[model samples]
Target: MADLAMPEIALLGTSADPPTLGHQALLEGLLQHFGQVATWASDNPMKRHGAALDQRCELLKTLVESIADPRLQLAQDLSSPFAIATLERAKQRWPDRRLCFVVGSDLARQIPSWKDAQRLLEQCVLVIVSREGWPLEQADLQILRRIGASPRMLPMSVPGTASSQVRRRQTTEQLPKCLLPLVLKHNLYGFNTTNP
Candidate 1:
């Protein structure tokens, strides 16, 4: 069992193909609630990424740096497609701290189908942040609770800008300014120098 007295650390893993204003807002919001927030860019097994894992990591790193908060860190080492594996790695890194796995409302419904999900839920507290379009349903929360996950809803409002929308639009308007140079340099997400 995790030590309840220990400091709570928020662990966020996302497919940050091109970290957007929304991602930055989410991290900033997390900082206001949690003592420490560790985030990383990872490959989602269910989705096809527009950028490579390394590139995505670089993009996320840039965003984390832009936040300029000591408590917020880009933990690329914890990147893993499987939540269980990421949770295990986090346990190894922060042996004494309580880990809270952070997810968006869009992903909250898919937790049960993940590999070793029960074990993952049992190990860490699940924190769900509501997205603009994806609303969390009572049925979903009940399902998560039934499977041993003590899910908590984060009251932060994140911008609706999504990576898929950015990719489809192929514009830099939705991306953070800090990430624009990297996106332009690599030409990721079909964004070019001419794109405003």
Candidate 2:
């Protein structure tokens, strides 16, 4: 058999309110293919009041504790104003590794609108996992190609869950078990959700 090669991959996610089992599943997948998996939480400008930066960072730490792999380290803040610049910094930090940016199909579809989308493509290879009901349009695909993103789809089913849905029903009796700890730690439900 030919030797197995480990791809250098980095996973980025938002523990915006809290991370659910689906997020854990994604990270597990990343650890399988990459030699090193660095995870970063997003400080999305659009999300007005999910969790503060420090709290979100703390929740990420809590969620990562369950993972057994040492390769998964906390990625520095990538939620800066210039996403492409942040990606460039990440490339420099991991000079010995082949950097790959991992995201869900929901976010993948909106790649064209991202800040400096072309520069982001030039800095890192994008690996987008499938999310159910998130239609991948030809226009977006063309845009990704134009930006030099070698997009590859992961063979996995999308978990029909989202932070929005979770926040909407915060008062429900039972919360998602996997994300309960994170939710409680960050006081996720305490935030005002007038805007996502």
Candidate 3:
């Protein structure tokens, strides 16, 4: 069990194929709600990624750097496809602080089915950030609680800019300006130097 008296650190892991403005907004919002926020880019294991893990990490690092907040850290060491494994690693790194695993509302329904879901819930508080299109349902929250999770809703709205749209349309409008040069240099997500 985490120490409630300790400061809470938000752990956010995502498949940042090409980090978008939405990701930046989410990170900023998390910083407002928590004392510290640790974010990383990792393979989701369930979905296919356009860029390699290292490339995604670079993009995420750029996004974190752009935020220019000391409280927001790009902790790639905690990157893991399994949330339980990430939480365990985080516990080792910050044993004195309470860990709050951050996930978007789109992923809320899949929590109960995750590996070692019960144990993961027991170790950290689950903080769900509401995405623009994906609404958080009461039934999903109930299911998470039934499976031993104490979930809290983050009172912030995430921009609707999704990486999928960027990849499918091969557009750079959704991407952060800092990532544009990297994306063009690497030719990631089928985007080339021709794109502005």
Off by over 4 Å in 2: 1-7, 77-81, 171-182, 190-196
Residue-by-residue lDDT tens digits, candidate 1, 152-176:
8988978888998889988777889
Model 3 / residue 160 / CA error / Å: 1.6
- Cand. 1 Cα-lDDT: 0.92
Q: Sort by lDDT, best first: what order?
A: 1, 3, 2
Model 3 alpha-carbon drift over 4 Å, by segment: none
Error of 2 at 111 (Å): 1.3
Please provide TM-scores, in order, for all candidate models, with all chains considered together: 0.98, 0.81, 0.98
Could you give candidate 2's per-residue lDDT for residues 69-90 as a string of tens digits? Answer: 8988777555554567667777
